[model samples]
Target: MRTGFFTHADCSRHEMGGWHPECPERLQAIQDQLIASRIDPFLQHREAPPASLEDIGRVHTQSAIARIRDHIPSPSEHYYSLDGDTFLNPFSWDAALHAAGAAIAATDAVVKGELANAFCAVRPPGHHATPTESMGFCLFNNVAIAARRALDVHGLERVAIVDFDVHHGNGTEAAFVGEDRVLMVSFFQHPFYPYSGTSDIGAHAVNVSVPAYSGGDQVRQLVTQNWLPALHAHRPQMIFVSAGFDAHREDDMGQLGLVEADYAWLTQQIMTIADQYAQGRIVSSLEGGYNLSALGRSVAAHLKVLAGLD
Candidate 1:
């Protein structure tokens, strides 16, 4: 089985604005680097299907879904602001659906053994959208939805969510804080945007709050000393990753110092855990990588490891 690569054209059409860092060009950059790195052909590509309201409602509130569905702007209108940073254009709704659908589809494919694992390269990057609200450029919580799907639909007893974004995945934590069936392990830069992972996270979560300018060595240590022990103890039946590359030194979105090699190492470590307990089933979704060049290179490195090309 190969690594499935899931995406959708609607994702590119969901732009916030010309000045936004989370532009359509982010997907193009990943594609460009995958082709340039010659890793594109190794991936089994799949166009994402739009997620149903039922699928979305598993992780989000009905009111939140209604709000997003009702607020989509007409083509004549450029955007509708959900918050200061998140906005909706005419295509934003479909894009958000497909972005989330990519994660769900990838989860299904991996769970069914159609693929060894999968990477969802779609966006309006999630991880910031909570159950009752959409914020930080996210319309839906993609990874959270995927994790829920793995448990509720597939009957998985144990699952893990790993987030290495620069900012805390406050939304994801909120979704599965005390759920014994889920174990969420993550390391995020502290005192950052959507800042809420530092205190009183439940027993089901192991959240490491690191300082800005922290390097790969620190992350590796944290993963080994913190994430790995908890992951092994949990023995997750499947693993879902909220893969974010903005921690790269070149990405101005945050001040962490991770590089491409660090990303490859991180994927390898996660793969090790998945192999041991999850039968190598992993579903990863894109989140928060801004620097075009760095994002491209970092995603390639991460995918190379997932595809066993590294």
Candidate 2:
């Protein structure tokens, strides 16, 4: 069995502007780090396909998809905003679709037993976008989309989405609130951007909102206490992760301080669950990580764990 790596060149094409933190270079940093660390040699690579309307319809409303597609500009210059932080450029439409599609394909591969697990390395990160609106430099909520696809298309009875991003997965929570058969657990800096996952949205939402500068201990506690218990109870058939490294101290995007070992430990924990209840079935995608060095190192460590090479 091999771990699948999913990405696309168009992900590099989707840039907001020259000064944006969510630049195309983020993917390059990750790719270079994976090769330099020699972690890229042991994985199965796949080109990400564009997600179709039916696939995206699993998570986003048709109107939202229509609005996004209608906003695509002619190859020169185009701009639109669902929020001040998230913007669309000329190639953003294609990039966003591919980012989403990578997650969908990875989910299918893992659930169908085509691969042991998968990782999507594409960009224009999702997980902040809700069903009706996009926010937080996110447009499609990739993990949620994969979860929904697993349940709907693969006919899986139960699935779990674990988001370890520094910020709460508000969009994922919103998408799955009160929805049985899907369990979402997340921990993020409280009073953070798009702050809404703290309180109970309904019966299905489990949030462990932490404060800033709270580092590995709090995160470890959440995983061991809040996440593991719920996961054991749910007995998910598959697991999906919104793997974000922006919580690192070097990353000013979020205030929480996490490091490479933290990410490796988190991946180890989740992979254990996948091995136990889900037959080692897992699909992870990159979410947030700003500082180039920290982001690359953290992601390389994570992939090392994912590929069982660490």
Candidate 3:
């Protein structure tokens, strides 16, 4: 089966500002690179549907949902800042909904045998947004909502989330801290933004934090030593990836020195786990990557692994 490619045009309209690093151009970069790398034609592309409030409410609080809805401004109005970095424009709510919806749609598609695996290319990158709050350029926790759907709607008992973002996925960790059914493994640059996941995370969370300026060797070593052992023991039923490429050496967003090859290698490792325990079912969503060139190259490498072309 072809891998699924999910995205929406509304994702391009949810910009925080002209100078923001999390710009809409990030999606365009990925698309352009996919075409340039000759990988676009090998996948099943789908336009994302907007997520219902009921779907979002499964992972977020009622008050948080109300705040995101209430903060939507008129088309002629200026953007409303939810925090120092996060903001809501007229189209932000729609974009956020579709970004999350893309994740849910991908999950449904993979779980129902319509596809082998899927990648969500939507924006307004989520991972920092918690259940009751939105921050760090995230208004909704997209991957968390999808994992919940896999568990609640698709009857999945053991779901796993692996995040490789440059920053800690504190919000995603918060959503499933003590849930025995879910196992989360991740590596992020330490002593950085959010300043979390350093220690004291619950048993379900395997947060391997590396010092600033660490490179791909550290990532490989951690996966071999820490993440692999945990994943093998857990034997997850489905695997979800919070795929973030900001750790790329070219991206100034974080100090981690990961390159495109690192992402491809890591994805191959995850694929081995999927083949072993999950019937090759995987869902991945874009989270953070600032440098356009690096983001595009890294995503293409990751997609090549997902599509079995590498």
What TM-scores do the predictions have? 0.99, 0.97, 0.99
Candidate 2 has a TM-score of 0.97
Measured by lDDT, the strongest candidate is 1
Q: Per-residue alpha-carbon lDDT of model 3 for 1-310, expressed as tens digits?
A: 9999999999999998898999999999999999999999998999999988888888899999889899898888869888998989999999999999999999999999999999999988789989999999998899999999999999999989999999999889988888999999999998899999987767789999899889998889988999999899899989999999999989999999999999999999999999999999999999999999999999999999999999
Instruction: Give the C-alpha miss distance for residue 228 in model 2, angstroms.
Output: 0.8
Q: After superposition, how far is residue 304 of candidate 2 from its true place, in Å?
A: 1.0
State model 1's lDDT.
Answer: 0.94
Per-residue lDDT, model 2, residue 212, is 89
Q: Count the backbone clashes (under 3 Å) in each candidate.
A: 0, 0, 0
**Alpha-carbon local distance difference test for all models:** 0.94, 0.87, 0.94
Consecutive 10-residue window with the lowest summed lDDT within model 1: 195-204
Candidate 2 off by > 4 Å: none
**Which of the predicted structures, 1 or 2, would earn the higher lDDT when compared with the native?**
1
Preferred candidate (lDDT higher): 2 or 3:
3
For residues 101-173, could you state the per-residue lDDT of candidate 1 as single tens digits?
Answer: 9999999999999999999999899899999999998999999999999899999999999999998998998
Residue 183 Cα positional deviation in candidate 3, in Å, after optimal superposition: 0.3
- Whole-model alpha-carbon lDDT for candidate 2: 0.87
